[model samples]
Target: MTTTLAWIDYLIMLIYLAFVLGIGFALKKFMKTSEDFFLSGRSIPAWVAGLAFISANLGAQEVIGMAASGAKYGIATSHFYWLGAIPAMVFVGIFMMPFYYGSRAHSVPEYLRLRFDEKTRGLNAITFAAMTVLSSGISMLAMAKLIVVLHIFDAPFASLGLSSEWIFHASIVLSAVIVLGYVYLGGLTSAIYNEVLQFFLIVAGFLPLVLLGLKNVGGWDGLRHSLPTGFTHAWVGMSQASTNPLGVEVFGLAMGLGFVLSFGYWCTDFLVVQRAMAADSMTSARRTPLIAAIPKMFFPFLVIMPGLIAIALPAVQEAAAQPGKAATATSWPSKGLIPAEAEKDPKTGEMVPKYLRQAGSDEPLLDANGQKQYAYDYNLAIPNMLLHYFPTGMLGLGLTALLASFMSGMAGNITAFNTVGTYDIYKAYINRSGTDRHYIWIGQLATLFGTIVSIAAAYAAAQFNNIMDALQLVFGFVNAPLFATFLLGMFWKRTTGHGAFFGLLSGTAAAAIFQSLTLPAGAGPGIKGGWLANLHTFPSEMAQNFWLAIFAWTTCFLVTIAVSLFTKAREDKDLVGLVYSLTEKPREDHLSWYKRPLALGIVVLIMTAALNLIFY
Candidate 1:
């Protein structure tokens, strides 16, 4: 099929890029000190920070991966949002912000030092710094892949007679340059400002696609009727791993995702909490994640719906057939798999490739052993829909929105990486004290280093099955057990630094062991075999991810408790503001009920529950 892009679409994308660049340059004057550059001088308003909070997480993986899941798992994919995000966001805004903001630590690893000890801080700092770079590389890779797959820059490249490899290289360098230009100048403030802008752009670009696609699919009722059994309901199959689309039971979903994974990401992942930490006041800081939770609750509609609709498309249905499956009216040959000697089309009289000539095209894409590839490349669901449904200018807008999302994700990771590098690692280890100007200079250098490493990672991310799967794998390795360490250090006074550090190590080992034991037959790269025997297999990737999180969290919790009993605890006086029991509660403001965190949290919870029921 041909990809379309009118002049107007190109113009719109150009204008959007120029607008964001202007905002970045405009904020350059605000970077006078390391604090201003790293944390926006702690002067950002809650609403702006709130939007950025969600936007920071809205990378290419989020948009394309979530939609991919929607196509593959149906409405059940909403669990990633409602069960895996909202509750934890609410918990952070209402309960965890005080320690983060009140303690005034520059980074999460610094918080680990203040609460535990330098040893604990060292482990988190190294792990987090590495994870940020790796994750940044994944974003870079995913965006470059999308550009090639969707042919976003195809027209310009074709006019210049460039090959697809040229398209991939150019996409990577262009994105890296744009992100480095803005983020290097204005630092975290620029990233946060651009993120808010990105949020609007994404909404503008995708909202129409969702509306038009839903109309084509006959709306909610049509989606329900057209999809397979258990595709529409979120809660029905969750009772047991065998029944649910995710292959995990209600207990695993609720505890593993709703508690462990969600808390680790929303509460402890500095990539997000860093945005909230920049809020202007205690109240704003407390309210930031809560406000973000509201928009977050509704995001599945914007990102996931395209995939749900794509599966209903006649072309996609035709392309989704397995190797031995019988042909049906809806089935067609998969794209990019045509053979040399193909038959002519009856209607158009054009030479159709052999692989795409029939409904159950016998010449399917296969491996060396002749095994069929995936039923469908679900990652193409949203891009395919965008090409089919959107007009010229609108299509440009959608592509620009996609580009903006990728940039924001890269910027978020880079900013987090630099802060941790400068404060938690450099300042803590390499230098005992430094001038404000010196640290700012170090931060700029760190950004350059991060960009270089991320470019390397982008190449590495290609080996994974999909962006979402790659991300979940990273989370299992690092973020899964992190919450247990933080939870004990924050709430339990007896949790010694030795215990916290060892527990973190123990939990990570458990994840590795469990993951190795349950590595599926065709597990992707980074998932090695032979560490532990494969005794059991998971029903789906999502189930494996959830259970991996559960095992890690439980192991950390138990280990920390046991180790703390044998180790000496820190004094209460030193734990002020860091430990919940030792810290004083914030003075209540005379603000109305709606302005209170409790009231806003309750409202968000109610909305989340309503969405779950609606989808269920």
Candidate 2:
């Protein structure tokens, strides 16, 4: 699993890094104002913002998690893209962007403050800031681990008389420096441009891998035969929780993922919304997500193919039956094979993972932790596929793409963190009337603070083997409930600040309570929950997350409506642009039918539905 990169690969990555820094430096002169730094001066074109919107999301969650789930759950992973992303992206660009963009607010939390109470905005701001840092850490962990696993920096480190063990730490430091260097200089504008770069790089880097992988696996038809039952199909076997690899029924998938978690992340998550908010006008803001959704509809093939191919390819000439169970480390074709627990080494009297062939075999199969030998490691599907297929020159491009994917996440999260920290938290609470120049200084400082916090968070991400699982769990807790609040506040003017705030608290509590009481079927009681009691068990972690979101959203929705009835409401004049009923609809009569948000939104939905059926 450890592959050393060549000088050519190193050179390609270096060039990409330099260009990344160059873009930041080039944009530095324009970032004098806080608006320019945090919101891109709202001067970006719709097309650029759209690309940045998608690229901002192509971090560890997209590249690593998508591929991991594809390997683990087959084409069902497409649900994360098609079912989870497209509709919400279209909705945000169409329905939500007007409130966010026209409100003249600095951030999402600021928008909340405009529509609701300060307390509600404060809670969201704090939680969102925390989530961004944690998310940034996850991206950092992916990059550092990739460098360590691939031994990408081994040559350079050794030449500098550094111990190989320092690779992980050094890599983390280097990754932080790269992201911080650009983000500190250009802020949101720099991150957005870099995201556009990452988007292109990811497509360019992964397209070859997908083409070569499918070629090796006998194309689509061959891949179907090579995969296990239901692995090639997305919608089939979804009727029953036990019938599919995803371990959830149709209802759970639709409501939990498609509705709750999907809307929670795409519609409300600041990580994505910040991109649209940076658009030049209401039209561009509305178009940002719609444009992103066009390419998003087909991204599954680019990202998910590697995982399917990774699992389908056999170490020997003949393929074997796909096996169940996940490993904590990088696995290549081994996900299709069963692995036993590590055995004790007779000589050292210490437990260590071992590769066995027969009754008398002694092959050293231990990973870096001496515990990741024979089992399936779903996390490395993308990394493994890249190594398996790419040659020297192409390998550098692939590695750069992978690193860029990670940077998109770190940069996006850090940028969002700085804005929220500076405006939502500091401006609102700490320093009520800071000068614009002072706030810009604070934002740059926040960037440094976020990177340092993310470094700590990256270490925390190592506890989870499945990166996507870790990601969804975070969203389920922070986002799922928040969406309920936003839905009611924007659509129902009767929803009071007290109601929204209390409903949010209750919803978060409900998520925590549900998690503590339920456990996935095969998982032991740990962070996967069931600490309080195993009152209910789920088919899988993904299933649990979806249901958790359902409960959270439901609780918040009901509680907010009920509480609003008992609380005082604000004046209609103040609520004009904030609430949907009071707010005038965005006009697109001057534009052609095809250019209208609704028309494009409907088309996107129709196309997404077709994809689900086609892959079913």
Candidate 3:
């Protein structure tokens, strides 16, 4: 089960890591102030910013998770990337960037403070900090797990008789330490530069795997033959219920949410936002996200395609035939075999599937159908494929590419953490009169602290049964609420401080309740029996919390709009310089009607719709 690492593979990874560290060291000279450390002194050009933006967002989880989704849902899973993400980026580049950039704010919370109040700003910053730490840590852990599964250090550690568990733990800590060191030294500048390098390397590494995989799978025609009937169809395998949780079931809601949520992340999330915020001017900041959108449209071809191919491989089938190694056949938890089905029930002393076992077991076993079943570890699919399929020199490149993904993502999170901590917390609370040097040091300290906390979070994430599910569940609970509040804040100027605050609270509560109460213990509703049966299994602890948040947000929005009609309005003068102010610009009498962005957005939407229609 062990693969030998070629010298070239080790050399390439070493060189890549060294180059990353070199950039960090080189950027130290630019670290004279907090602004420079956190935003690259606003000197980055549109292209660099664009590349960094895309790279930073494509962490280890993306590579593995998308692949896992592909394995489970087929091409339908690409909706998250293509249908959900691209149009959103287009919207952000054309519309949202103007406001965010014009504000000249260091963090999203800082913008909140200017638009709302101090309490709102502080609350958001802390929440963001907590979520970022947890998300980034889990990402690091996933990347390290991939390395162990790929056997990158297999030969070197063989003499030590280390178990995979030991290797997994060591990899996580080691990867974090390396990332922390470079991020601490260079801040955003180093992170972005390294991201650019990592971006190219990851593509180079991944392209080969895709090509080889397609070839091994007997070409596109053969792949289709091996997969389920609806395998290539974008919407074929998805349950209508799975795609829409709100019961509203409108195509627009699905499409709009896909577009809106994606825009919210690429355009507004601090991790990606920091890239544009680092640009030299409004023009660069605005252009960077648009420029980044081009590659994002193409990512599915690289990231998701491999997962589709993974299921077609002979090895996966062969592995499934063994005593304890089943490939997941469905995305829904209840549809797949459970733990108790793979082992003997303790109470009755009868064999049960591992996934159905009331209590978990350390040992692996086989399902009744004689398939090897690792019910707890679906995320291992992509890494396992790499180990089996990639050749020697190629293996090195692939491993390096995976590591690059981890580095880029970690660097992005660290940059966001440092910027928010320095600008929002340090400036707002401690040492307001601090000198430039003092601020730079504080930024570095914040990054260090953030990295440490993230590492702990990653360890905690390992305990969860389904990493990808947990990640989405967490986002659904947190980001949905934030999205509601921000949406009202930007578009509805009549929204009062109380409205904004309560709206956020309500939206968060609503999402939390839905996520906790609607989702089953080991299964989401769609697969449990039908949607209704599954909904009954929703975790009680989180149900009321999410509902309350959503209620609060909606009530606040309504009340605020009402109050604004009767109350004295805030001076329009204070808001004149913000993003929405562009609408007030005098229309040019001779303005040309190129419609380039509109045309592009239309084309993207059409293409996406056409593909889905044809695929289904």
User: Number of backbone collisions per candidate, in order?
Assistant: 2, 0, 46
Query: lDDT per model, in order?
Result: 0.83, 0.85, 0.67
Candidate 1: lDDT of 185?
90
* Rank list by lDDT: 2, 1, 3
Stretches of candidate 3 exceeding 4 Å from the true structure: 158-166, 236-239, 242-260, 316-377, 463-475, 515-517, 520-568, 579-616
Which candidate has the top score in TM-score?
2
RMSD of each: 5.8, 5.4, 6.0
Question: Of the candidates numbered 2 and 3, which has the greater lDDT value?
Answer: 2
Which is the leading candidate under lDDT? 2
Considering summed lDDT, which 10 consecutive residues are worst modelled in model 1?
A: 318-327
What is the per-residue lDDT of model 2 for residues 214-284, given as tens digits with 9 covering 90 to 100? 88888999999998879989988899998999899999999999898889888888888999999999998
TM per candidate: 0.89, 0.91, 0.82
What is candidate 3's lDDT per residue for 330-385, written digit by digit as tens? 22122221111245567988444455323255454557896554453445455556
Superposed by TM-score, candidate 1 places the C-alpha of residue 484 at a distance from the truth, in angstroms, of 0.9
On a 0 to 1 TM-score scale, where does candidate 2 land against the true structure? 0.91
Backbone clash tally (model 2)? 0
Off by over 4 Å in 1: 161-164, 316-374, 462-475, 520-531
